[model samples]
Structures are given as C-alpha cells and as structure tokens.
Target: MPEGLIVKALSGYYYVQNSEGGQPVQCRGRGIFKNRGESPLVGDRVLFSETENGEGTVEEILPRFSELIRPQIANADLAVLVFSVVRPELNLLLLDKFLVHTEHARMNALLVFTKMDRIPDDEEGESIRRVVEDARALYSSIGYEVILTSAHEGEGMDKLRQALAGHINMLAGQSGVGKSSLVNALVPGLTLATNEISTKLGRGKHTTRHVELIPLAGGGYMADTPGFSQLDFAELGIDEIGSCFREFRERASTCKFRGCTHTHEPHCAVLQAKEQGEISESRYSHYVGFMTEWKETKRRY
Candidate 1:
C-alpha cells in the first residue's frame, strides 16, 4: 500500500505515479470501484497498494477541484481550442461551446488558430490575421487569451510554448483540425497520431479516440483529447451561461432588469453593443443561441 497520482486511465488499467516513483506504476482498481460508482480519471491523486512484484492496486481516489465529462479529466488548468482558418473552416458556434464548457469546468480557455501557412497572399494573410486579431480582442475583452499558430510553419510557436509553459492544458477541437500535429510541434519527438482532412467532406477524420496527457519539454502537461461533432449544452443552466461570455457581464449589469436573459429583454446593453458595432455580431449570435437553448433545456428538465 502506497500513495500515488493517477496520470492516465484507459481500457481497464490506471497508470499511477508513486510518491517515490522511478517510473509510473500501472495499476487496476479493486472491484470496489463498481459498487461505489467511482472511476479513476487523469489528474486524480489516489492511494494505492504496491505489490513486491512492482504491480499496484488503486485503494482510494482523492477529492477533485473540477471534472470534465467529455474528456473526463480532473483539475485541468486550461482548455486549448484548436481550429484551422481554412480547410474545415472555423466554427464560431463550436468555439463558443468549448469556451463555455471550459468556464463551466473552472478552467481557462485558450484559443489556438492553426494552419496559418495556408493563408495566401500578403494581403490575404493580413486579412486572415485581422480576423484572428478581432477574435483575440473578442475573447480578451471577456478575459480569455487567444493565440495564432501553424504547426507546419512554426509560426507563434514560441508564444504558444510560453502560454502553455506552466498549465495543464487540454487540447480540444473538431477532428482533422491538427490537434495532434500541434502537440507534436510543441514537443518535438512526441509524434502522436495525426490525420488529414477528408477531401469529400472538407473536414478532418476523427483520429484521437482517447485523452492522454503528454509532458512538455519545458515543464507542463498537454492533454490530447478526442474530437467530437457536437457538445451537450443541456448540462449548463441559463444562469451559468451569461458569466461564460465575459464581454457581456460589463454591459449586462446596465440592463434594466436584474437578471437579464438579453433575449427580448427591454433595454439590454448587449443588444445595444451589437447595434453600435462594439461587440462582434458572430459572438453575440452565439450568446443568443446558447442562452435560448439553455433556457429551453431548463424548461424541459
């Protein structure tokens, strides 16, 4: 019996790193897990029993600060949302969903726009850069950081490295968006599997089927997560939605009502921002869509 941390869990095996570990000790939980409704997840600190033969058994799971249902990781510091500017194209809707989920999980959201090399022409590249800058501003206004990247060309690699320097980052995005490629670029020699975008669908094939945390060269962990077509917003309530969109908070406070949904609410500052060309229409639309769906789901539940 010894103390350790669960670094990775897959199939039915858990990799536990002991307090005096030379290497991570692989262990399986006792059958008690099934009865107690407990499943060990990554980032979980646990007590384990070590056999003389170098095997181990998970004895108990420690408390967690937060848990993400999709990737099923615990105590994540940040969520890196990766997307390409062209190929599959950027889905602002999905981006918002990831940001909301990150906030709900109590983790910071970092936007990483990949594949900048594809943006042709000095003029065209500048245009694309402007779009990214605008997006950066939009998220930054709401207290999130956004960075541009090209896993192939190595653009912004330094900044990306610095940004991910100390945090436990979970890399999340749709399939074929180069999440794995970015990981390989960040920590050379860690060639995680990567797939090309489908020509027929103009999208990426979902390659990463599970989540695994890779230690960076400097000093941090980057989680390579599975890709998905959609996220379940029903898990979040209407009240929890507004705070995720940080830009809205400042103006939302000025709304006439105490608890403004910002949809059909009289004298809403968010609407005014859209009218005044202050907030990007795309983000406002995302907020409205999410707010509407959350309210509907709440009613149904």
Candidate 2:
C-alpha cells in the first residue's frame, strides 16, 4: 500500500496528497472504517490503495502525534493564532481561549497579530500598540512566539513564514481577524475567500467549511479552517481546565491542594501569583470564565 497525507475531506471524499509529492489523489475510506467507528481526518497520514478509476481507498491511519477533537484536525504541530491589532481590535480574552485549546491539543501556538498598517498614526495608535505589546509579552512569557505583521505592506510576513516553515501549522482565529489576508500575503495568487460569496465553490465565503490543508512553498503544510469565535469546553473536564493555562499549570504544583481548581483555595499558588503580579490578570479571568462555563455545562449533563 502507498502512504499519503489526507489534505482535504469534502462530502465524503478524502484528497490524499501522495507522499512522493504530486497532485492529491482523491480517495474514500473503506467501509471497515465506519464499522470500526474510525474516520480519516485532514492531516492524517494514511495507507491507501489506488483504485482502477484513479481514486483510492484508505486502508489504515498512521498513529498521530496530536489530534484536536474540536476542529477534528490531526497531527498539526502549531496553531497560528491569527488576530488583528486595529480593526476589530485584538481580543485578549479570545486569544486566551485559543491558547487553551492549542495547549489542550498538545501543539505549539504562534500569535500573529495582523493589520499593523491599518493602525492610525495618532494617540489611539499608541494605545493599540501598547495593548499589542502587552499581549505579546504575556503570551511570549508563557513560551508562545508572537509576530506582528502588516498584510498590506507585507511586513513581518517573513518571520511568520519562518515560524510556519517545516511544520504542520493551523490558522485559527475569529472572522475579521485577517487570517485570509495573512494567508494571501504568505502565499500569493492563491486568494482565499474572506467572508464573501465564492463563485467557484458555489457557497458562501466559508469555503473552508471542512478543514483543508494547503501545500506551502516549503515542506510545511497549513490547515485552512473556517474562522470560529467560540470554543465551548464541551470535551474538557473542570479539573483539566487549569492545566490548559500554561502559567496556571506551572504554579499549580505548589498550590495547597494536589488537584486545586485555583478558585478561592487556601494557599493557592496561582492566586498568589496573580496577587503578586506574576500571572496575567487577563489570563486568570479567562480561566475563571472557562471554569464557570465548564461547571454549568458539566451540570447539564
């Protein structure tokens, strides 16, 4: 059997990119997969056999290093948390949510702050830059790389590319954060639909309805997905929430309780860190928000 990477799956068809590097071979999974309750996902390395009609059937899925259950993408190495600095403004709360998901997925995250050119050269611009710097410092302190880029002027794109190169990167952010624009800047002429009706797909601008991996110039492959705003902690437990925040995880060991929720616990290291300015208040707030949601969601079940 020949091995390949599943780059895209649409309407029950899996487009497997040949391992040797050529046009993707359209393939379908065997009926046994359904019987076994297993399905192929984009970014899955698969063993498949070519059919007489040039299509193929996946025989087996190779073991994945990491899999994101929410988006259903497998083996992604990094999540490029795309956001904008000016227009819609940067949402620290939302960025923290993405970070938690990326952390849970066991993948590195890169913060790409887009739309630098759109920032007005005035007092307001200074304020925006201040927030951006703050976010960059906060996330970088937790070991995430932050890159500021102006898609209009192509500034900082090289750095973005360098971070993505040779890695399975996933572009994840809310709509209107310039994810498409940044992808366009990185790969010219391959324009992605930016929330507009796409004639080619005959669908609305969410052409990436299903996650699709676009081949990059270098060895890297990027999974282009629909921009979504919300990530409910449906798959996460209340105890698992604290570990999602990197800073919280670091301080949790010294917490008074072995399995501290970090909420009103006596001698909690995480709370102490927040009071002592060791942890970002914004991140801690998000953690509380998630815990609340998780508690409510957990009770409903």
Candidate 3:
C-alpha cells in the first residue's frame, strides 16, 4: 500500500503521483470505493495499492481541506478570478457569485483584472483605477488579494506569478478574459490555446474544455478551467454570505441584528456604509441581488 495525490483525471483514467514511489501511477479505484459511494477528484490525496503493471487501485480518499464545485477540484490553495476591463465589461453579479463560491470552499480568492492593454490607460485609466480601487477595497476588505494582469502587453504577469509562486491556484473567469493566455505566459511553452475575443459578441470562445494542472517553472502548479457564464450559489445560505465580502464584514458586525442580512434590517451597519459611500453601492447592490436570486432559486428546490 502507498499514498499519492490524484493530479489529473482524463478519459476515465486517474493519474496519481506517488511521492514514495517517485513516479505517476495510472490507477482506478477498487470496488470498496464504489461500495462506500466515494469517487476521487483531482487534487485529492489518497492511499492506494501498487500493482505490478505500473498502475494501482485507489483504496482511500483522504479528507479534502477544500472543494470547489465549479472546477470540481479539491484542496486548492486559491482561486484566481480573471475578468477583462473592457470588451465584455465586468460582470458584477457573476464576479460576486464566484467569490462566494470560492469562500464556501474555504479557498482564498485572488481577483485578476486581465486584458488591461486592450483598454488603453489613456482612455480607461481613471475608470480602471476606480474599478481597481473599488475592487481592492471591496474584496481586500473581505481578506482576499486582488491583482491586475494584462496578457496582451504583459503588464502584471510578474506580480501575478509572484502571488502564485508557491500556491496551487485554480484559474477561472468568464470565457475569453485570457485565462488561458495567462496560463501560457506563466508556463511559457505549455501553450494553452487562446482565442480572439469576438467583436460582435464581446466574449472569447471557450479555449479550455476541462480542468488540467500545469506545473510551473519555479514551483507550484495551476489548474486551468473552461469559461463559465454562471456559478451555483444556492448552496451558500444568505446568513453566512456576508463574511465573504471582506470589506463589509467589519462594518457588518455593527449591524443591529446578530445575524443581519444587511437588507431591510434597522440601523444595519452594512446599509449604513452603503449610504455613507463607505462601501461601493455597486457591490452592495450585487450582494442584495445575489441574496435575492439565491432565495428565489432555493425555493424551487
């Protein structure tokens, strides 16, 4: 028996990298896994039996520290949410959803603003500054790190790499925000397919179809995922959603109610901040919208 980490899953095959064995072992789970109703996911650490055929059967799946439903991976160090400044514009609703989802998984969220070169600084600097500042104050206030990146003119690649240098990060964003391009830049010859953003639709074609971990040059690895338009938030209840907004949490604690939903609560600290312009109205609006959507969506189930 040996222990290994499930690094990749493809074509009904699981690739496990065994440290003790010093090699990747292609393996499948035994009937015990099926009987116990356990299926392995990428980034999962497991115990297995090494077979003579250079493969093995997974016997046990170690408890996952965190799990993300969108990419369906476990034990991620962080999630990089990439979005473009122009082209498709920023989707606040989707961005909030991703943030909440990442927090629910107990993974740190890194906001990456990509395609900055496309939106020239001369034309979009002030606007971009406001957006970056608002995002920084909004997310950073919630304990997340927000980074600016540009794959076109290579603006923030070094900073982005520095952030991901020692962490196992998962890259996500709306399709065509250059998630793949960033990955290509980070890994160089890895060359993940990148597509042109459609002028008519203002979105990029899906270049990555499935999640794959690419090992970085110095250390660490990154998981590349397909572009997504919507994410599931019904699993995250409204009461626990506030802490996900780092900026709002401190002010939120001052709300009149112990479990204030920040909507319609008397003397709500969160709403007070919104009115005082301490928190961006745009972000607060998105929070309310997310709660409303979640409530409606949950009622059906």
Candidate 4:
C-alpha cells in the first residue's frame, strides 16, 4: 500500500496525493472505516491502494495530532485567523472566539490583520490603527504571533509566506476579510475568486465554499475555507471552558479551590489578575459569556 495525504474530500470521494504524484488518486473509504465511525478528512495521511482505473481504496487513516471542527481538516499545524481593521470592522469579541477554538483544537494560531490599506489617512484612521495596535499587543502578550498584512500593497506577504512554510495552515475568518485575496497574494497566479464587501451589511459574501488544501510554492500547504461569521461553544463543558484561555489557565493553579470555576470564587487568582490589569477585561468577559452559555445549555439538556 502506498501512503499519501488526502488533499480534498468531496461527495464521498477522497483525492489522495501520493508521494509519486501526478494527478491525485480518487479514492473511496473502505467499509471498515465506516464501521469504525471514521471518515477521511483533508490533511489526513492515509494508506491506500490504486487499481488499473486509477481510482483507489483508502485502507487506513493515520493518527492526527490536530483537527479543526468548522473546516473539518486534520493535521494542520497552524490556523491563520485573518481579520480586517476596517470595512467589516475589527470584532475583538469574534477574534477571541476564534482564538478559543484554535487553542481548544491544540494548534498554533497566527493572527493576520488584513486590509491595512483600507484604513483612511485621516484622524479616524489613526484611531483605528491605535485600536489595532492594542489588539496586536494584547494577543501577542498572551503568546500569539500577530502579523500585519495588506493584500492591496503586498505588505507583510513575505512574513506570511515564511510563517506558512513547512506547516499546513488553515486560513479562516469572517467573509470578506480578504481570506481569498490573501491566499492569492501568498500564492501568486492562483487568482482565487474574491467578492467586494456589501457596503450596506458591512460583510463580504462567501467566496470559498469548500475546503481544499493548496500547495505553497515555497513549501507546506494552506487550506482556503469558506469564511464564517459566528462560532458557538455549545460542544464545550462549563468546567472545560477556562482551559481555552491561555492567560487564565496559567494562573488557575493559584485559586483557592482546586476545581475553582473562577466565577465568584474566593481568592481566585484569575479574578485577581483581571482586577490587577493582567487579563484584558474584554477577554474575561468573553470567558464569562462562554461559561454562562455552557451553564444554560446544561440546564436545557
């Protein structure tokens, strides 16, 4: 059996790109996989056998170190969380939601602020720049790699390329934030379809509808996925929510109780950190929001 990476999965077929690749071999999952409650996902390293017709049968799916839920990719080493400083407006709350998901999935996240050129040269632009700077500072301080980018001027393209080299990255963000444009910039001549932002709605229409890993010229791969605006923590438990926030997790051990929920608990180190200006109030608020949602969900279930 030859081993290859599953670059695309669509309509019950897996496109396996083997080491001796020409075109990807179209493969179908064996019955054993269904019996085992497994389905092939893009970025999965799979073992398969090819027949005379060039179609193949997937024999096994190797272990995955990381997996993303929304885009349904596996073995991705990084998630490039793209956002814009203008147009759609920087939604720190939404960005924090992405960070929580990225952390929970056990993959490194690189924050890419796109559409830098759209910032006006007037006073408002400067104010927006300050806000973006603050956000970059906050996320970087908490140990995330933030890269500033402008698809229009090609700024930060080199840095983006360098960070993506030798790793599989999933490009994700709200629709119209230039996820497609950024992909085109990083991989020239790719010419991915891009849509203009709806001025009335302040949102971009979805361009990339499905997930497919594109091989980078330098090295590694990037999956351009359909942009989405919302994420829910319905799958997460109340007790598990705190671990998603890296800063809170660091100081959780010092709380008064071993299983401290950090909500109205006495001598809670996380709460103390929030009061001492250590944790950003916005992030703490989001944490509490997730906790509240989880609690509500438990009640209904």
Q: Give the top-scoring candidate (TM-score).
A: 4
lDDT of 2 by residue, 110-163 (tens): 899988998889999999989889888888888888999998898998888888
Return the number of clashes found in candidate 4.
Answer: 0
lDDT of 1 by residue, 1-301 (tens): 5777677788888998776757888898989988989888887778998878887899898888878889888877888999888787766788988888887887888889988888878896788778767777777776777788888889989999999987778889888888888999998888788877789999877777777777787777888888878887788877678867777767888988887877778798877877898877888888888978877877888
> What does candidate 4's lDDT look like per residue over 1-301, in tens digits?
8999999888899999997778899999999988888888999999999989879999999999877778899999899999999988898989988888888888889999999999999999999999999999999999999999998899899998999999999999999889999998888789899999998998889998678989998899999887886787777776668988999999998999988888899999999999999999999998988888777877888
TM-score of each: 0.91, 0.94, 0.90, 0.96
Q: Judging by lDDT, tell me the better candidate of 1 and 4.
A: 4
> On lDDT, who's better, 2 or 3?
2
Q: Least accurate stretch of 10 residues (summed lDDT) in model 4?
A: 232-241
Residue pairs with backbone overlap in model 2: none
Instruction: Per model, state how many residue pairs clash.
Output: 1, 0, 4, 0
Task: Check candidate 4 and list the clashing pairs.
Answer: none
Per-candidate local distance difference test: 0.82, 0.85, 0.80, 0.90
For residue 80, model 3's alpha carbon misses the true position, in angstroms, by 0.9
- TM-score of structure candidate 2: 0.94
lDDT of 3 by residue, 1-301 (tens): 6788887888767788885647688888777777887778888888888788888888889998888777888788888899887777866678887887776677887899877776655756678667666766776765667777787678888888888877778989999788888888888777788888899898889888777767777677798877887776677788768877766777877888898899898999888888887787777888888888888889988
lDDT of 3: 0.80
